[model samples]
Every structure is written in C-alpha cells, then in structure tokens.
Target chain A: MSFELFSNLVGAFFTLCIFSFLYKDNPFYQAAEQMLVGISLGYGLVYTYNRVFVPYVYQTIIIQHQFVLIIPAIMGMLYLLRFSRKLGWLSRYPIAFSMMGVGMGVPMGIHAAILVQMRQAMVPIESFNLFLIFIGTIAVLLYFFFSKAHKGVYGKFVNVGKWYMMIGFGASFGLTVMARISLLIGRIQFLVNDVIGILK
Target chain B: MKKTIPLLIVIVGGLIWVVWAFSPHYVLQEVFYNQFYLPWAYASASFAMLLGVLSLTMMHSNKIKMRAPKWQYSYFFFASFVITCLAGFIGGIQKGGLFMWMFENVQMPMSATMFSLLAFYMASAAYKAFRARSPEATVLLIAAIVVMLAQVPLGVKLSKHLPTISQWILDVPNLASKRGIMLGVGLGSVATSLKILLGIERSYLGGD
Candidate 1:
C-alpha cells in the first residue's frame, strides 16, 4: 500500500483502540502503553548520547584530547557499578555529585529569575484604572497573609481578599473547562477529518 | 576513609559551583558551565537511564524465573526492549534505519493512542464529576456545557453570541485565575528550591 493509505489506516485503528479503553482496560491499551514507554526511553537515550555525551566527552577527550576528561569519564563509569551490590557504594559518589550539583544550581538559578521576577510582578505600576489595580493587588496580598488574626479593621481587607480569591478560582475553573472543551473539539475534528474524511 | 572523602568533595564542589554561577566574573561562569555543569548533567542522566534499564531487566527476569502467570507478557516486554535497544545502537550509525522506522511507526502511533484515550476518559469522568447537584456544581456544569458547545461549529451556527461569551470567559477571568495560580506555584517552587539548597530537604539525598 502507499504510505498515505497506510498512515490513514493506522491512524484510524489507533483512534479506535484508544477509544476502546473507555469501555474497559484491555490488552490493546496495555500494548500501546508499553510500546510508548519503550519507544520514548529509546529515543531519549539516543538523543542524550548524541546531544550531550558525544560533544562533552569527544571534544574533551578525542578532539582536544585533554587529560582532564579522564577524571569525569571515570566518575561517569562508576555509575554502572550500581547494578552490583558489592560495588553499589561507588555509585553513590556520582549520585552525590549530581544531587549536590542540582541542589546548588536550583537556588542560584532561581535567585535572579524567580525572586527578582516575582518582586517585579508584585510591584504595581501607575495606571488610570488605579482603583482596580490597587484593589486586586492588596486583596491578593491579604489573601496570602496569615501571621496575624484577620478581625475588625483587618477583617474587611480579609473579606476583600476572600472575594478576589474566589473570583480567581472561578476564572481558573472556567479556563480549565474551556481547555477541555478545545481538546474535545480537536478529537472530534480528527474523527471527522481523518476517519471519515468528510472535512477533506 | 573511602566514602567520607568523596561525600565531602561533592558537598564542597557543589557549594563552589553555586557560588561561581552567581559570580560577576566571566571566568568562573565558563568553568562552571563548560567544565562542570553540562558534563555533570549528562553523566548523571546517563547513569539514571542505565539504572532504570537495569531495574526493568531485573523485574522481568525475576518474573520469568518465578514462572509468574503474566510471564509471557513480561517476555514480550523484554524482547521489545532488547530489540529496540539493539536497533537504536545499530541505527545510531545510520541516520534513518530500523530504529527510526520503529520509533516513527510503532512508538508514535502508541503515543497518539494513549493521548486519544484521555478524551474518552475525560468524558466518563466528567459524566460522574460534573453533576449539577449543588449551586457550585450547577455553575460548573453550566460553564462546562457552554464552553463545550461554543467549541464546536454547531454552537456557532446555533448562536453567534456564544463565541464572544466563550472568548470573554477565557480571556479576562481565565487569564486572571491562571496568573494567580502561577504566582502561587512560583512561590511554592521558590520555597522548595530554597529548602533543597539549604539542605533542609535532605529526603532527596536518600535519607537522614
């Protein structure tokens, strides 16, 4: 069969197989799930090898052929020792290194990007609709504040916060609904366009 | 003598890398990124992948040895895993080969299948969850129905006004709510990262 015909046939079959899961769990869904996991893993491994290891290692060791590459390469090899119970302790060296690296990187990375950005977002700007901005900002901030008791003078502010929070949640719920609706429309379109070819 | 020294090195090295990242000097940044960061990420990820594969192998091997009832399925899984790995290893040399074929044909279809299943699952879940039993649920059900109807061309043909309402619901209120959620999420993430950085959340290190 032609590639187009083959693709159309396979697409239709997959669409049905996926929909079949609604009735009950079956071998088809299981097969599809397992195949997906395997393929994704396989692809990820290949991509990583090409993109990361080759450049980093080959440049240092083979091309530039620096002696320093040997240290990291050996450290990397120690990771394989994890499979052996006796040598598993060696694996911890690489693991510890990775954990420390990530732990250290995250905070430093977030310092400017997250903290600075958040502070900027909170800082109100002058606008003609200052009342709305003021109300929204103060109410949102009040919604988060929990150190002191929210009563009397603070109670009114807390109530305003409650209203803003509710509106925020309501709006979020509405967006989620719309997103799901869009997804549903896309599937229906697929069924119409690909399966029946009516749209075509 | 053996483990303690390595652990200390890791800790000290990690602190140095963090400090270097925030440093104003270009030399420190170059050393961290080129010499340390990229290599470390790759090496760690590779090891993690290897560990995952090993666990998969061990699990299936045990199932086979014990003659489990679903051993046949495990065998299928193992066979597929080995075949795919071999294909990848071989096909990596050639740009478009058996590995690429399997990925595009077998893998892509399966992923699409899994994704499409979400539609049916959502429908059933919505049927159960979106009951208009209370004032809140009623509002939810109404919003869902309106959104769902407005998405389809049929809704547009039925009433031109609905699309505008849907757009408003999505743009104004939805955008505001999303921003609020994002702000909360951002704060939570910052807190968690700080905790991890300070060694307060040492659970990630595999225990106390």
Candidate 2:
C-alpha cells in the first residue's frame, strides 16, 4: 500500500481501538489509552525542550551570557531536587515561586471576574429581556447567600434564582453534548469517506 | 529556614503585585513585571512541564518493575514514548517528517475518537439520569431540549421562534446566572490568595 493509504489504515485501527471501549474496556482500549499517554508526554517533552528551554533558558543565559537570567534557571533546577529524599525540602522554593504567580493573580481575577462581571450586569433595564436578565442575576446572587433562611419574601427571589441556575446548567450540558456529537460525526465521516474510499 | 524563606517569598511577591495594582507606575508595570517577573514565570513553566514528563516516566517504569495490575500496558507506554521521542529527536520536529506523520495519523484521530466516545455516554446519561421529578427538573429538561434542538434545522422546522427563544434563554438567564457564579468564585480566589500570602494557609507547605 502507498504511505497515504497506510496512514489511513493505521488511523482506522487506532480509531477502532478507542471505539471498542463503548462495548467494554478490553486490551484494545487499554493499549490505545497507554499509547495516548506515552505519545502525548513524549510530544510534550520534545516541544518544551525546543520551544521553551532553548531560547528562554539555554540561549539567554548560556549563549548570550545574560547571567541574571540564571536566577530562574537555578530556581527551575531546584524542582529536580524534588526527586532527592534529603534535598526534597528545597523543592518548596520552586513551589513558593509558582505560588507567587498565583497569589499575584488575585488582583487581576478580582478586576476581570468580579468587578467587570458586576459592571456588565448593571446595564439599564431598557426592555423586558434586560429586566429578566437583571432580575435573574440578582436572584442567583441571593440564592448563593446563605446567611438568610429561605422562608420569607426574599426566599421567593432565591427560588427564582435556583430556576435560573438550573436553566444555565441545562444550557451548558446541551452545548457540551452537541460539541461531542459534532466531534463524533467528524470521526465517523473520516471512517466512512477516507478509510473506505482508500480501500476501494 | 527552608519553609520560612519560601513563605516570605510568596508574601513579598504578592505585596509587590498589590503595589503595582494600586500605583500603576511604569517601573512596576514595565521594568519589574514585564522585564523580570513574566520571563521568570515563563521559563519556570518549562521546568514544570519537564517535571510532569519525568514523573510519568518514573510512574510507568516503577509499574513495570513492580509488575503492578495490568503492568503489561506499561511496556506499551514505554515503547510508544521511546518511539515517539526517537522520531521527533532524529527526524527533527521543526520539519515535517515521521513525527508529524505519526502525530497527524495516530494522535489526532485517536484523541478525537476517544473524546467522541463521550457523546454516546452522555446520551446514556441524559436518558437515565435526567428525569423531571420536580418543577426545577422539568424546567432544566425543557431548557436542555430546546438548546440541543436549536443547534440543528429540525428545531427551526418545528417552530419558527424556537431559535429566538433558545437565544434569549442563553443570552439572558444563562449569562446572568453564570456571572453570579463567577463573582462567587472570584471572591473565594481572592480570599484564598490573601490567606496564602498572610501565612494563614500553610497547606501549600505540606502542612495542615
């Protein structure tokens, strides 16, 4: 067979290997799973080595002799110390450095997620749709409020919030299912057209 | 000394961000952040990815050595990993060759097929679990059906306004409720970060 045909056959085989899981988890599925894990990691390892380690660390510090860049290189090296038993405590330095990034991200998160979201929701209720949306947003917030018991006039608003949340979740579920279905359709198209046409 | 210094690093780093946020000065924005902090974080992420690769390698090797349950699968892992690494390193990943071919044929199809399997399982889940036991459940089911139908031509055929109603459902209630959830999460994130910076949350240091 030609290389293109051979490639299609290999693709068809692995596709079948994965689809076998729909029936039951057999060696075929397990083999494909293992292959996926291994190959993805290998791809990641090589990509990171080339794309990241090369220009960022090796080229900058070693080749260019920008010695200040070695600070993070040394910090990065500290991560490998995690493999050592006695020096495992040193690994915390890298962890802390990583956490610094996370901690610093709080102000950004507050601005984008909370403040901007709140501002976006605070639109003037010019129409029925806007009124519904504004009310729905308020209700959802009230539903999340736990200090007050769900028994009074305010509780009614909370009940409305609960309905809006259910609708939101349902919409999300529907979107995800349809996306997966489209992906399935693409794979089936590949099998029906590409694989079968080559055989013919 | 090891633990204390790391804690201090997080606090001092976080405080710098707080200062940057409030001040908006060029030195903090350009020199300190863009020049120093970003590159350091970028380079560190590479080392982190290397750790993940190493961790997987160690796990598979140990599994094979110990003859763990379904340990034969580990051999497949090693073989594929070695073969892929050899292909990439030897053929050169930057140019189109064996590595690209394997990735296009084996990886793409298998990954897409594997995820597509979820559609079948989701169909099963929707049928078995999504019962309209209460008014809330009924609303959820109706909304789900409407949203799913809106994607295809059949829903439009059934009712001319189905698409409009579906869009309204998404743009109004769905967006609003999602925003509420986002606010809650953002608040929690800020609180957690503050606790971490203040040394109140020592859990990251492998403590209670």
Candidate 3:
C-alpha cells in the first residue's frame, strides 16, 4: 500500500482503539493514550525549541551580538533551576517576572470584557425586549452582591436574577452538548470517509 | 532574602507593564514591551516547557523504578517520546516528513477520539439532570431543549419558529446574564492582579 493509505489505516485503528473506551477501558485505549502523551510532549518541545528559542535567543544573542538580551537569557536558565532541590527558590524570580507580565496584561482584558460589555448593555430601551435585557443584567449583577442580605424588595430582584442565570447556564450547557456532538460527528466522518472509503 | 527579592522583581516588573499599558509614548509602547519584555517573556515561556517535560519524565521514571502497576506502559511513553523527538529534529516538520506523518496518524486521531468521547458523557448527564424539578429547573429545561432542537435540521422541519425563539432567548436573556457574570469576573481579575502586584499575595513565591 502507499504511505498515505497505510497512515490512514493506522489513524483509523488508533481512533477505534480510543473509541473502545466507550465499552470499557482496555489495553488498546491505554496504549493509545500513553503514545499520545509522549508524542505530544515531544512535538511541543521540538516546536518550542525551533520556533521560539532559536529565533529569539540563539539568533538574537549570538548572531546579532545583542548582549543585552542576556538578562532574560539568564532568567530563562534560572527557570530550570527549579529542578534543583536547594536552588529551587531562584526559579521564583522568573516566575514573578512572568506573573507580572500576566498581571499587567489584565487591564486590557478588563477593558474588553467588562467596560465594553457594560457599554453594550446600555440599550435605548425603546422596546420591551431591550428593557427586559437591561433589567435582567442589573438583577443578575445584584445577585452577585454578597454584602447585602437577600430580603424584602431587593430579594425580589435577586430572584429574577437567579432565574436569568439559570436560563443562561442552560443555554451554555446546550451549546456545549452540540459542540461535543459535532466532535463525535467529525470522528464518525473520518471513520467512514477516510478509513472505510464509504463516502467521497 | 529569596522571597523579598522575588517580591521586588514582581513590583518593578508589574509597574513597567502598567506604565507601558497606560503610557502612549512611542518608546514605552513600541520599544520597551515589543523589544525588551516580549523577547524575555517568550524565552522564559520556551524554557518553562522544559520544566513540564522534566517533571513528566521523573514521574514516569520513578513509577518504573518502584515497579508500579502498568510500569510497562511507561516504556511506551519513553520510546514514543524519543522516536518523535528524533523524527522531528532529524526529519524536520516539512510536508511528507516522518514527523508530520506520525502526528497525523497518531496524535490527531487520538485527540479527536478523546474529545469525541465527551459526547457520551454529556448525553448521560443531560438525561439525568434535565428534569423539570422546580420553576427555575423547568425554565432551564425548556430553554435547553429549544436551543438544542434549533441546532439540528430536524428541528427546522418540526417548526420554523424554533430557530427564531432560540435566537431570541440567546440574544436577550442569555447575553444579559453572561455579560453580568463576565463583568464581575473581569473586575475580580483586575483586583487580584493588583493584589499580586502589591505583594499582598505572595503565594506565587511558593511557601512561607
């Protein structure tokens, strides 16, 4: 057989091996899982080294003669120091710096997620649908307000918030189911079209 | 000294990022982050993956040393890892290469199979948990059914209005609550980031 055909058959076998888990866990599924973990890790390491480490550090520092990049180069080495029992504390420096980058980036996320969302919530309320949306948003936000006791007039609004949140969660769950089903359909398509050649 | 030094680094590094974000100066925005911070971050991230690989290797090695159950399977992991690394490094990732061939034949199918298995779990979950136990549950069940049915071709055949009602439900009530929760989470993240920057939360430093 041609290499392409052989590869497709192997892929089909592996797919069936994993699907065997639906019946119950077996050696076939276990072997497939282990091979996947090892191969994925290997792929990640080589990809990172080739794409990121080479271009950024090797080329920039050595060839370009940018000695300044050595600072982060040292920091990156220090990250590996975590493997050492005694010198593990040194890893915290790089971790802290990376966390700082992550922390500082949060403001941009807040701008997009919160500020923009709040802005979008400000509808003209010309229609009943718009008004209901406006009220639903406010009520839900109030539900998350932990300081106030849920009683009296405020409690009624909180109840409305609870209902809205439930409906929202239900919709999300439905979407999730659809997404999973789509994945199943994709696998079935592969099995039928590629493996069995039942479909063109 | 260890904890104190890391905290200082966090504060200084965080301040630079904040300054870079808020400041519109060409140097801060363009030169500082793009030139300096980004390369360092990328280098750090690349090296960080080594830590994960090392941890995995040590775990499996120790498992083999102890003669743990399924110790033979660890050999599969080690051999696969070595073979893949050799293929990738020697062959390169170009089209029709061994690396690409292995990835297509092995990794892709396995990942899809694993993800697809979630469909069975979700179906079982929906069967059990989707009952109309209360007023809220009833609303949730009805909304879920409407949304699910609207997605399939059979639903359109059942009723043209199913899709419209599902869209309305999503566009109005769902968006409102989703926005509300997201706003809260965004604000909370900003607050936590500030706490971390200020050195109030030192858990990242590992221990007391």
Candidate 4:
C-alpha cells in the first residue's frame, strides 16, 4: 500500500481506539492518550523552536549581530531556572514581566468586552422585543449584584434575572452539544470516507 | 527580598506598558513595541512552554523511576516524543515529511476522537440529569429541547417554526444574560489587574 493509504488506516485505527473509551478505559485508549500528550508537546516544541527561537533569537542575534537582544535572552533563560529549587525565585521576574504587560492591556479588554457590549445593549426601544432585552440585561446584572438583600421589588428583578440566566445556560449547553455532535460526525466521516473508502 | 523585588518588577513593568499606552507618538508606540516589548514577550512565552515541557519530563521521569502503575505507558510517551522530534528535526515540518505525516496520522485523529467522545458522555449526562423537578428545571428543559431539536433537519420538518423560535430565544434573552455576565467578568478582571499592578494582590509572589 502507498504511504497515504497506510497512514489513513493507522489514523482510523487510533480514532477507534479513542472512541473505545465510551465503552470503558482500555489499553488502546491509554496508549493513544499517552501518544497524544507526547506528540502534542513535541509538535509544539518543534514549531516554537523553529518559528520563534530560530528566527527571534538565533537569526536576530547570532546572524544579524544585534547585541542588545541579549537582555531579553537572559531573562528568558532565567525562566528555565524555575526547575532549579535554589534559583526558582528568579523565574518570578519573567512571570512578573509578562503579568504586568497583560495587566496593562486591561483597558483594551474593558473597551471591547464591556463598553462595546453595553453599547450594543443600548438599543432603541422601537420594538417591544428590544425593550425586553434591555430589561433582561439589567435584571441579569442585578442578579449578580449581591450587596443588597434580595427582597421586595429587588427580589422580583433578581428572580427575572434567574430566568434569563437559565435560558442563557441552556443556549450555551445546546451549542456545546451541537459542537460535540459535529465533531463525532467528522470522525465518522473520516472512518467511512478515508479508512473504508465506502463513501467514494 | 524575593517578594519585594518581584513586586517592584511588576510595578515597573506595568508602568512601562501603561506609559506606552498613553504615549501617542509614533516612536513611543511603534518603535518601542517592535524594538523591546515584542521580542521580550515572544522570548518569554517560548521559555514558558519550555517550563511546561520540563515539568512534564520531570513528572514522567519520577514516575518511571519509582515504577509507578502504568509506568510502561510512560515509555510510550517518551518514544513518541523522541520519534516526533526526530521527524521534525531530520525531515522538516512541511508536507511529505515524517513530522507532518505523523501529525496527520496520529495527533490530529487522536485529539479529534478524544473530543468527539464528549458527545457520548454529554448524551449520557442529559439522559440522567435533565429531569424536570421544578419550574426552573422545566424552563431549562424546554429551552434545551427546543435548541437541540432545531439543530436537526427532522426537527425543522416536524415544525417549520421550530428553528425560528430557537433563533429568537438565543438572540434575545440568551444574548442579554450573556452580555450581563461578560460585563461583570470584564470589570472583575480589570479590578484584579489594577490590584496586581498596585501590589494589593501578591498571590503571584508564590506564598499564601
């Protein structure tokens, strides 16, 4: 058989091995899972080394002779010292560096996630549906606000919030189930089309 | 000294970015990011993955040394790692090479199948857990049923309006609640970030 055919057969076999977990955990499932972990890590490492390390560090510094690049290079190296029990404290520098950068990007997050969403929620009340959405959004927000005692008029709004939240959760769960089913469909397609050649 | 120094680094590092954010000048925004921050972040992220790789190696090696249960399977991990790395290094990562071949034949199928198994587990969960015991449970059940049925062609055939109702349910109350939750989460994260920068949150310094 050609390499492509052989590879497709192997792929289908492993795919079945993984699906065997629905029956019960077995040696085939364990082997496939272990191989997955190893392969994923190996693939990630090679891509990072080739794409990031080689281009950014090796090419920029060694080939191009940008001596200033040594600063971050040393900092990155320091991150590996976390494995050393004695020098693990040094890794916090790089950790802090990355965290601070992420922290400073919060304004952008607020702009996109909060301001934009709030803007979208502020629809013109031309339709009763728009008005319902407006109330639903406020009620849901009030549901999360735990400072006030949930009684009287406030309690009624909070109760409405609960319904909205439940519907939201239901919608999300439905989407998740659809996604899972699609993934199963994809695997079945592979089995039939590629492995058995039935579809062809 | 350790805690103090890291906190100082966090403050100083944060201040640099905040400064960059406010700095509207071309040189400050473009030149600074390209010259300094971008390279540092890239190197830091790559090293971060190396830390993960190191931790996994250490954990597996220790397990192997003690001959833990399923220790033989650890060999599978090591063997696959070696084979994959060898393939990538020796033959390159593009098509027709061993690396891409192994990825297509082994890694992609395994991950896809593993994720697809969730469909079975979720189906089982829905069977056992989706009982209507209360008004709230009944509401959730009906909404879930409507959405689920709407996804299939047979459901649409059964009732022409099923898809339209599902779309309305998702687009209205569902979206409103999601936006509310998103706002809360966004504000909470921003607050925590500010606390971190201000040294009020020192959990990242390691100790409880």
Q: In candidate 1 chain A, where is summed lDDT lowest over 10 consecutive residues?
A: A128-137
Chain A vs native chain A, TM-score per candidate? 0.71, 0.96, 0.92, 0.94
Report lDDT (CA) for all predictions. 0.62, 0.86, 0.87, 0.85
Q: Which pairs clash in the backbone of model 2?
A: none
- For model 2, residues B1-208, the per-residue Cα lDDT tens digits are 7789999988898788878877779999999888988888767768888778778889988998899999999988888888888998888795468887878888889999989999999989888768888898888888899999999999899998988988988999899889888888888888888888788887887631
DockQ comparisons of all candidates to the true complex: 0.32, 0.77, 0.74, 0.75
Clashes of each: 0, 0, 0, 0
Residue B201, candidate 4: alpha-carbon lDDT: 88
TM-scores, all candidates, are: 0.77, 0.96, 0.96, 0.96
Which of the CAPRI classes, incorrect, acceptable, medium or high, describes model 3?
medium
lDDT tens digits, residue span B29-98, model 4: 8876777788867755777778888989888998899999988888889999989999998889999899
Candidate 1 per-residue lDDT, tens place, A1-200, comes to 56655655665565566566777877766555555666676676676666666777666578876667667667877777777767777776776667666545556546654565456445555753434444554556566767877888887776665554544454445455556555555656666776577324
What are the fnat scores of the candidates, in the order listed?
Answer: 0.24, 0.75, 0.74, 0.70
Kindly state the fnat score of candidate 3: 0.74
The per-residue C-alpha lDDT of model 3 at residue A18 equals 92
Per-residue accuracy of model 1 over B1-208 as CA lDDT, tens digit each:
3456556656566667677766757766777666666765664465566666667778778988999865656755766676777787776735468777666566665565565556556667667866766555565556556666677788899899987876665554343334444455666766775565555655543421
- Residue-by-residue lDDT tens digits, candidate 3, A4-119: 67888898899999999999988888888889999999999889889998898889889988878888888878888887888999999889878887556667867887889888
> Model 3 off-target regions past 4 Å?
A198-200
Candidate 4 reaches a DockQ of 0.75
Interface DockQ of candidate 1: 0.32
Give per-residue lDDT, candidate 3, residue B118: 93
